[model samples]
Target: MSKTANAGGHEGSAPHLHRLVLFSDAVFAIAITLLAIEIHPPEHWTSIADLFGQMGHKLWAYAVSFAVIGVYWISHRRIFARLRTANGVLDVLNLVVLGLIGLLPLVTELLWEHGGAAAIVYLGLVTAIGFALAALWGYAAFAGELTGPVHRGEALFTLARVAIAPGLMCGLIFFALNHAWGLILLALALGAFIAGGRYMRRQAEQAVEIDQPEEASA
Candidate 1:
């Protein structure tokens, strides 16, 4: 009886998981679309050049927010790919992450309009999202809710993966205090995150292939 209960709890139901993933994908799509709407063209400009010049900062903010949301979506997809089951705790954490994502549009528009500490609020939203990711991932990983092909340490790597952006954001906040180049650091930190995540995923997949050489060969 204990063994049966254990199996039921660990595996849950795949259909439920599929529905959750579908819902998540739809929300992410909507969030990305909303981000683009943050960049509004001015109703009046002296010339086309003036219009483009005024748009420069808004365009930059839009680009940053767009990339940030896309990264989170990709990370979410990657995490779900190796998930074996979801528990109540995971569900709550997932909702918190999504809630933070939904706030990006507000923060994006506010920062483009307000500047100043608005930048920090934007980055702080990202940091909260990162911490949520870490908690959700840690629960799934330590609870043995990861799939079979996941390497022994890959989930731990994921914890590290989601943590990097927030850690770098702290540096961004420092730079903002010292030099006002925080936006530049934001771009750089995101670039490093995308590059590093790809590398880590590739390495993990290769390790899995090596471990299951017979299946790999077949």
Candidate 2:
């Protein structure tokens, strides 16, 4: 009887986690679709040059928003792949991340319509999303029986990967506050993100080396 109950519990928990992932995926899909829907072609363009010029802002906004949302989708997949189960708190945290993701299209529109002046608002939303994702990962990894054994180095690397770009972008955007300089800040943020990734990867490797000996003996 006890064995049957244990098997039933395990079966039930997996479906719960599966349902959560499916719902999150649907939200991501809708958000990306909304972004593309926001880009409408110019109604009256005489030449290729005129068409390109008119569509430039919309195209740029769509590209950036697509890339950002794509990254979060990948990160979300990675984080959930590491989990073994979910609790109420984990469910709430997942929703928080999804909720922030759902706002990207609106912010992308703001960027398209207002240019650099709207960047702070756009990047601020991104920053919030990044931090919320980090928090969700942290909670799942550390708060009870949600995730399996997470390596220390890997955890640090994951946090750095998910959090650093938006944080840097947000800080830089505050100073630039325009479309042209916003591109410059993005380049800077990418460079810094790469450097931070390398540093975190090295830390993770060292952690693995340190743990290997202890793990072998045990």
Candidate 3:
């Protein structure tokens, strides 16, 4: 079945979604693996004490990077799950999003090695992905590529849900620019992101539920 309610007309569009999602999954897997390769064993290993002492930030950074990439992958999966039909534009847009995701490993390592402005770049890239995500949702809804019927209000709700990531990332970047404790602020920012995501997803779900007709709901 198509992910959207009214994607019947666009079923014949070029580039099957199967291929696109497969390619996207490959990219995501590679990026996640690269995150581990970025982390190296402590050099001149001696004992548990030396190992623990040497691999301080690297461990923390790897954990954080892993979490970050995982979040992106989950979001990407959800979006594609909703994809009813694929056309050239939709496939290209998805590829663009994948391209940005592919850069996360490199940027994550850079952020770990150099913290002054790399955080800004990293968050900025995430924000771009957020925008691209918003764009994808907007296009699918507007182009009638979604599986079910999507009203304008419901579409806006979907947009808001995906838009939360970049919006908060942008705010965090600004927070870091003016504040001395950028690192500490990141903890707060991440917490806020989690909270916001939960709230937005709930809102979108409610909207979709309300819009889905009783007969069509089944």
Best by lDDT: 2
Candidate 1 TM-score over all chains jointly: 0.75
Candidates in order, TM-scores: namely: 0.75, 0.80, 0.71
* Candidate 2 regions with alpha-carbon error over 4 angstroms: 1-11, 167-192, 195-218
- Model 2: lDDT to the true structure: 0.80
Error of 2 at 66 (Å): 0.5
Candidate with the larger lDDT of 1 and 2: 2
**For model 2, how does the per-residue alpha-carbon lDDT over 1-218 read when each residue is reduced to its tens digit?**
22322332444667878998999999999999999998888999999999989998888778778878888999899899987776667778889999999999999999999987888898889989999999988777765446766666668768866875655755555455445677786787788767876777687678779889999999
By TM-score, who's the top model here? 2
The ten-residue window of minimal lDDT in model 2 covers 1-10
TM-score of 2: 0.80
Which residue segments of model 1 deviate by more than 4 Å? 1-12, 144-146, 166-218
lDDT of each: 0.74, 0.80, 0.70
